[model samples]
Target: MLASKSIKMSKEQVSTFPNADELLDRMRKMSEDESLWKKSKTDSGVDIFEGKVSTKYRQFRGVGYVDQPLATMVSVVKDAEKRKQWNEQMMGNEVVEDISEHVKVIHSKFNGGAASNRDFCVFYTDHLSDTEYIDAQTSIIHEKCPVMKGFVRATCLISGTRMIAESPTRTKVFYLGQVDLGGMVPSFVANIVNMKQPLCIARMRDFAMKDAASSSSVPSSASTSPQEEKQNEEK
Candidate 1:
């Protein structure tokens, strides 16, 4: 029915196919696609038989569109709670097997990358906990996240974000800072994360896309290496 689907799409929409499969296959896939919105519409045709089912159906969420902000918020909260449990186990001096249950809670199989960024965070923590854990985590962002390397000044509100205003612009990234120590003691690590809005994302785009070396944003030195900056823009 969708014979004209070959119409050209811009680079962005090109990745997000509105209709990925025929009606029946979509119905079958719905059980596996949690975010899919499956619906049926009446099929009015002159040649339909009485036993026929509704022929027009749709399922979609588009690619590269994981509700980034929503996913960021959800991931932060979910990971934080799980991490809290891990800390508790750590405080109790629990070992590897004990902390693993907490790790599984945060693993995301959604887009299927060799374990996503969040998974990496969980895996690293699995090996490093208690004493070594602190250094491993703080070093992770520096080693893995370019943003943290050049942090000028940052604050973590119970909001699960670090509001950073670099010279060029301000940004509030959800997974950016260390947890505030005030909430739960004796290994209590509660990092807050707020819901992501369109504005929140737009505000950070300047920093993300900026020529980091030139931008005077944030007082600290820049950490984005020449090689990695090139990689980021390709994404």
Candidate 2:
């Protein structure tokens, strides 16, 4: 069985991040391979694939569904300041530069459990295409933000999110990322990446769904600005 599995997976699919369609296609093939290996080892709702992008770097592709509107999901994802609320390992996250309506540079630091904390300064630009799908990607070169001490800056070679509306109120999110976390990675760190990536998707879904529910429950008269909502939550 193992031999047959290996033979089956040898059929190559494009691993490079040339475009969104190619990325999505690669993810589909990865999902199939992962399913064949061991279903029990993977997350229930997320399809995860790992590959080597370079000698010391790895690429990850994750696809998951969120039961929330595309707009709601995108809004939550684009709000970098609020990410720590749901993202498990985000110790610090901030928008370093807002270049335009759809372009900005974000700095984020992550705790690696026992390992040294890792950080990345990324220039991100997001836009809704003609097909109504939201595309967001982090620039490979982000010199606007300074790297912090004690946190090794990661190289986000290719990292982005693609959101497509599967239904009026449901969105299919696809994530593709290739990062080089500086220094040697322990087994625990790799395991954390495998587990935490799926959990991140679950967290985003929960956050967006909860927000949608709360928004729907509020009376139109009580509708308030985001600042008002935040103040109320704090109070």
TM-scores of the models, in the order given: 0.16, 0.64
* Model 2 clash tally, residue pairs: 0
Each candidate: RMSD: 23.5, 10.7
Best by TM-score: 2
Worst 10 residues of 1 by lDDT: 132-141
Query: In candidate 1, what are the lDDT values of residues 8-118, reduced to their tens digit?
Result: 435454222222123223323332343433222211111111112211221111111112233232232235453343222221111222223322111111111232111
In model 1, residue pairs whose N, Cα or C atoms come closer than 3 Å (at least 3 residues apart or on different chains), thus clashing, are 160-192, 160-193, 166-217, 166-218, 167-217, 167-218
Candidate 2: global Cα-lDDT? 0.60
- Model 1 spans > 4 angstroms off: 1-121, 124-192, 197-200, 212-235
Candidate 2 wrongly placed segments (more than 4 Å): 1-42, 52-55, 95-98, 130-144, 186-195, 219-235
Q: In model 2, what is the error at residue 117, expressed in angstroms?
A: 2.1
> Which lDDT value does model 2 have at 34?
46
